[model samples]
Target: MFSYRHAFHAGNHADVLKHTILVHVLDYFNRKDAPYWVIDTHAGAGIYDLRSEWATKRGEFADGLDRLLAAQAMPDAIERYLQAVQHFNPDGVANFYPGSPWLALQAMRGRDRLRLFEMHPTEIEVLRDNLKREAAGTQRQVAVYQADGFNGLKSQLPPAPRRGIVLIDPSYEDKRDYRHTVQALSEGLKRFATGCFIVWYPLVQRREVADLQRALTRLATPWLHATLSVSKPAATGLGLHGSGMFVVNPPWTLHDALATTLPWLKATLAQDDRANFTLARHGD
Candidate 1:
């Protein structure tokens, strides 16, 4: 259960899709004066070194974030997302990657709070150390826990301000993660009906992948779903071909932003002619 490590795939295509929408949601939340909490259910190590042994072993970012940074005339949303990533690489070089926890810190204001949970013991320690070094002042605004995010989430719902964004992005290494994702979201809604929820799932050939998509869409909530398929599944079906993001109670402007961004992104990340994208809302 603790085998999966995000450092291996930190800035890959999935991260592109997940973090871009995350940045948009954070930006939307900031538009209002009411303070809101950002709860990351599966927070990783907070930051990753692209040159590290784990990251260099895979070099997945070469086809993901590196492509975007090398491209020109990015869509508005994608551009903003890149800018956020650039915030971590202040020397104007993309040598490091910031995970959801770090990205949330970039957008959160003084009144806003961030709650993170990670089940992996090693990752929890790294997360805390990263915060200590890079976010010294965030001690009061951020909380990190080494516990199961899926089960621990209940205690943090319906935050003191009654406004929050719950991000459920388990690694799904365990087959049960798919089921747990659906269950967590269902329970989360009951506690914070109006809170924004962002879920990220891989586009694999597994039945659970399809089942998770179906379950999320059928929920009784206004939502938006977006996917980016960079290639057709391999013959052995051993690797991720793409990924999707489902946003419940999404911002009014989110659908349009993604509609304009996905097309260009599909072309940018295409591994073959099978590369494509999807953007749909509840009524669609």
Candidate 2:
């Protein structure tokens, strides 16, 4: 069952990194005249209310986007991400947060198409409603499905749009999720080798993260991995200390973009000594 709900962690440090890179990728895709497709596996409610009980319960944004917003002389990548979020919050008072699907919609053009899959019924309803409320009148095309994202991805592969991005942002609530990500990504690459893939993972214990990286590296496809750790090593066993993103067939500009933005993020959001950032490419 799909028990993962993004409401509790919207706008956290991980979202900051994932969405920043997502915006850049979408922007790059838009640069071309040919139409492109965006498929969001594990799509959550398109928008989130920071003041809502779920969000306010942890107030995660306070440690993430909030800090990034307060930082001075922001990098261009971060500036673009903030601009997108600002689009949702016209008054500039951070009240709402846009998940990947909504963020992708904001950057989509008339020729672009969006395919979103959310297994959670309530989240699926909210996702549809939010899209209707926020995307009305836009010429961009969208298709949402209330089904398993893993299965949804396989069904939609090699979309009418031969060119596009496939985003995999599973909740990772289940240990099996890690294995599922690798399996799904391996299959996706086989079907759409040219499509860009972005996989987001939380950085908790060293062993888990290392195993994930090892599995990703084993994929018989070229990929790039980037990570931004914002907290010190937890005291033995604790909560999420940081997060990372693995990009398969990443845009050439993404490397430079993250290089410029990650340091700023580390300095602005790091809560302890283990905070740092790393950029690497595996498989040419």
Candidate 3:
């Protein structure tokens, strides 16, 4: 039983980092005239209401997107993400937030295709309604499923699309999720070696996170790993204070974009003194 509801954490520090990179990737794909497909493994509700009870309980976004939104002279990459967020909350009230599906839909050209998978029944219903409401009168194709994202990878890979992007953003609600990420990503690379793959993971303790990185590096895949830590070590050492994104077959321009955006993220989102960034290529 999957009980991870993204509503509570939508637009948090991790979401900021993941969605920023995602937007840049989509932008790169849009530069080409050829059509491309995007597979969103673990796609949550297409949109989120920041004013809802879930969002207001802890108000996680208050420390994430809120900081980004308040910054001046933002980098272009961040500007694109913030602009998309603004589009969803036209009143400038920021009452709503767009998840991966909605963000991909905003960036997709008419020829592009999107495949979204969500396992939660209630979230899936919200996802469908959100997509229908936002994509009305448009021919841009979309396919959504209430199934396991890991299975969707095997079933939908190499999606009639020679070129594509597949995003794996699991809730990590279970400790088993970490191992599942490794296994699923291994299979995905075997099936779609050339497709761009983005995997997001949180950083709680340095040792555990390092082990995860070493495991991914052992895959011997050509990939780039970028990390942004938002706080100092916790006294209890039990909460997420930082996060990272692993990109397989990243676009040539992504490294440069990260160089510019990550420093700013650290400055804006850090909750304590331990904030930093790392950009490295794996299996090069």
How much lDDT does each candidate structure score?
Answer: 0.94, 0.87, 0.87
| RMSD to truth, every model | 0.9, 1.6, 1.7
- For 78-187, candidate 2 gives per-residue lDDT tens digits of 99999999999999798999998889888988888889988888999998888888879653499888887887899888988699899998888787778888889989
Q: What TM-score does each of the candidates earn?
A: 0.99, 0.95, 0.95
Could you say which candidate leads in TM-score?
1
Candidate 3: pairs in clash:
none
> Residue by residue across 1-284, what tens digits does model 3's lDDT show?
66778899988999999999999999998889999989998999888999999998989999999988888878899999999899888888888989888888888887889999898989899888877887784434898888999887889877786889999878776666777888888898888899999999998764656777888877677888999888876889777888899999988889889999999898889887888888888554
Candidate 3 lDDT = 0.87
Ten contiguous residues minimizing lDDT sum, candidate 1:
275-284
Candidate 2 colliding pairs = none
Ranked by TM-score, top first = 1, 2, 3
Answer with 1 or 2, whichever has the higher TM-score. Answer: 1
Could you tell me how far off, in angstroms, the CA of residue 35 lies in candidate 3 after the best superposition?
0.7
Error of model 2, residue 7, in angstroms: 1.2
RMSD in angstroms, candidate 2?
1.6
